[model samples]
Target: MSGESAPRATVGSESLERAFGGTAACNACGARVAEYRVVALFLHETAAIRAYCARCYPAAADGDYHAGGDGLRLDYAAFAARFGAPGPPPPPTTPVDRMLAALVADPALRLLAPGSEAVARRRRRVPYPVRVGFALDGATSEARMSVAPDGRMTDLAGDPAACDRVRALLAGI
Candidate 1:
């Protein structure tokens, strides 16, 4: 799958009818198809979701059939990359960066004090607000995690145990 060949994401014979309502070109075949696979990864989200007709679909490269679902598993390599990346995401430039990296690396994310969960400025007398949230890849409304000048961490609504854990993870940042 790597010998100077890479499949570009595209759909042949695409049209408005197929995209919105009528016939859309199938991903595997150029024929105008209306139905897309429940798990198809279309080149374009606005277009049909990389659906194939009854004939083209149902074929699995790994030949593994999933129960109660039709999505052919993509991202085998992506899965490998995620797990294969040694250590953590990388060192951060800011307190929030360290906090985020730690959180993402920690598979056992949960509330330490009673709920769920960075940074430096051990010298600064003023506390600064750091926003945290669930969404990683996109922008989200973040809950505040403040850092007291003397190195006191406040996660969410000032959960002490959670702060301690987060602090341990983000030490020396």
Candidate 2:
């Protein structure tokens, strides 16, 4: 989405002032953002601050607003092609993959490059498929890995630590 904040949307002056200091996630993509625009609040109590990047706040049709490198703006297809798209359902996973996934998920894991898109995209593709299992909220989650030509993740079993982390970083949607 566009890096610029939204233009005037007719929010109250007080509301805008409050938003200046607070932070909120983008309603369109869930990326953490500063409260720049207040839409509506629940039960007429609080301001339901719904701020989005310039691109997402305006042209986005659904929630999946994709921004480009400059964070300028983009349509869905272009976003998907440049940045890896979310994967579809896959088959079962293996024990090794599961462990790796957990390590990947760990906040302490230092495997992936820090704030490196080239590394993130390049490393996503595995020469061979890997699988992993995980537990969340007392439920079992599995993750599978698939490689692609652009070195992006083609498919993954959910909750796989590496898959989840990288996906979250890359997409942020």
Best by lDDT: 2
Give Cα distance to truth, residue 61, candidate 2, Å: 48
Give me the runs in candidate 2 sitting further than 4 Å from their true place. Answer: 1-127, 148-150, 157-166, 169-173
lDDT against the true structure, each candidate: 0.32, 0.34
- Most TM-score-accurate candidate: 1
Off by over 4 Å in 1: 1-95, 111-144, 147-157
Encode model 2's per-residue lDDT on 98-131: one tens digit a residue: 3233333333332211112222233454443444
Tell me the TM-score of model 2.
Answer: 0.23
**Ten-residue region with minimum lDDT total, candidate 1:** 110-119
